[model samples]
Target: MRIVATNPDQTQAVGKKLAALLQPGDLILLAGDLGAGKTTFTKGLALGLGIKRNIKSPTFTLIREYKEGRLPLYHMDVYRLEDGGAEDLGLEEYFNGDGVSVVEWASFIPEELPAEYLEIRLNKDETDDNKRYIDFNAQGKHYEKLVAKLAE
Candidate 1:
């Protein structure tokens, strides 16, 4: 599914909708350039998950855990990770944990990803400052259905 977000709020609204379909052990891969609103979308996802606390990008800390929500939210940012460094983080535990996992700059550690996941790519529009082109690529049957529902 592809969506055009006219502003940050719309992007976050899309994330909120997507979050409703998430389940434990689900993986979300986010790809986009700097200032592409990845964190904003995640904020909306957190809200959808029933998380009430402030949501911030885990750029420096690498991973932030929020367990107060309906399900735990393990948000990760691997932009600073060097090639092959993801192995040391034991990320598999989180990926398979009883929560949803969202990874920013997921392309940085493609080898560490599981076989099934939902990849969301955000691209900024050159013509509009707040506009973004969001693309959703679903892998595996569950994600396929999730995407289908979102497309509806």
Candidate 2:
């Protein structure tokens, strides 16, 4: 599916919509460049999950956990990883845990991700300042359910 985001709030709204469809052990992979509103979308996700605390990118920390929501939120930014794969960060635990995981710069840690995921790509539009085109591609049966829910 394709979504047109005219501003940060729109992007967040999109995330909120997706968040409603999330389940435990689900992995949401976000792919995009810096300043592409990935964090903005995450904030909306946090809100949708019933989390009121401040939601910030874990760029420096590698992973940030939030348990105040309906399900735990394991927010991760893999942009800082150097060499080793999931073993380096022991990130396999998070992927297999009982929570919803949203990984920013997920492409940087492809091998660490599940066999399937709800992949979201954000792209800047050259025609406008707040314009963005977001794409959603699902893989595996689990994501197929998510896609169907998202369509509804």
Top-scoring candidate (TM-score): 1
lDDT of 1: 0.93
**Candidate 2 per-residue lDDT over residues 21-77, each given as its tens digit:** 888889888888898888998998998999999999899998999999988999999
Which RMSD does model 1 reach against the true structure? 0.9
**Model 1, range 9-111, lDDT digits (tens) per residue?**
9999998998888899999999899999899999989999999999999999999999998889999999998556899999999999999999999888988
Global lDDT of each candidate: 0.93, 0.86
The candidate scoring highest on lDDT is 1
**Residue 147 lDDT, candidate 1, scale 0-100:** 94
Model 2 pairs in collision: none
Looking at candidate 1, the ten consecutive residues that score lowest on lDDT are 79-88
- Report the lDDT of model 1 for residue 34: 95
